[model samples]
Target: MSHVSRSAAVPPDDLSGPLTLDDLENRADKAYARHMETYTAVTVLHRVHMDHAVWNDTASDTLGLAREMVTAYRDVTRKEWYEAYIAWATAAGFEIPADMVNDGTDIPTGAADDPPDHPVY
Candidate 1:
């Protein structure tokens, strides 16, 4: 990985100059995080805000699974960070997708799955 959590999501402090093999792994980890974040964001948009029932429900079903499946690679902190970020962004007037739409049944444990990974990467 890109030494992401190892250095709290960044290259090591010692590597201040050009990119070398020593920092390659860290860079890769950073790339992984970036891609994963982008993917989750898109999936959220389509799977939540967009009407999935209009389609065959196959894509939405798969996207739902993908959303939960990718969380395995992230640490606990990263997972909480993402959730908090969503709330913050929404409060900041940024349109964000909810986990569920038109559903008012709030189960206390709805979001209590094993989010040990960033989102289950």
Candidate 2:
């Protein structure tokens, strides 16, 4: 894992009780940049985990399971972060298969695409 800066999302201090507008702007920039860095890091980790460790010589049925996980996470994040990840994956030639993008529906829980029978390793 890469080491991201652990600094607080606050601006540098000066000889003042509270922050000024400039200080607030600087703090905002810092916070946004930090958020972007963490976002990129998470995208990288997800791709590596999917392509290397999780799906290494894995079966298509198991791959569906992984896609299901990605979709579930996408749902939690309201698909915003997932869209960023999709862009990153596409740029990296990962081509997130269509199966991964789940259709938004109010179906009952635990009722999704079933795994293939006699799934090959």
Candidate 3:
């Protein structure tokens, strides 16, 4: 996995003046990349900890704690990035159509007449 780092400079939160959409998009993109990098690192640490259980338990526990800390950092970074994107989009007057729905599935609108094949439980 590729290494990701957060930018030293973040976009100012002051929305008192006009801001370009392109600039906002660029900031959001950078934030997203940083978040992904942290997330990948945390996942890798977790896998390593689980796979090397034969090693000293004390070392493994320390690594597990590190993974948990990084996971929390990744979650916060992701949320901040999402909020920035939404704020910029709203400031630019980008609106979602009333007819559109986001169900986190690839199924097209009005195309799935039956429920999913698998049970929720």
Best by lDDT: 3
Per-residue lDDT over 1-121 for candidate 2, one digit per residue giving the tens place of the 0 to 100 score: 2132233232324545544344444444554354344434445445555566445456645655665665555444434444444433433345465655546653212222222222233
lDDT, candidate 3, equals 0.57
TM-score for each predicted model, relative to the true structure: 0.27, 0.30, 0.58
TM-score of 2: 0.30
RMSD from true fold, candidate 1: 14.5
- The C-alpha lDDT values of all candidates are 0.43, 0.43, 0.57
Error of 3 at 88 (Å): 2.1
Better-scoring candidate (TM-score), 2 or 3: 3
Alpha carbon lDDT of residue 43, candidate 3?
59
Backbone clash pairs in model 3 (N, Cα, C under 3 Å; residues 3+ apart or in different chains), count: 0
In candidate 3, position 13 carries an lDDT of 69
Residues 57-108 of candidate 3: C-alpha lDDT, one tens digit per residue: 7887888788778767866776666655665555455673332333544312
lDDT of 1 at 31: 46
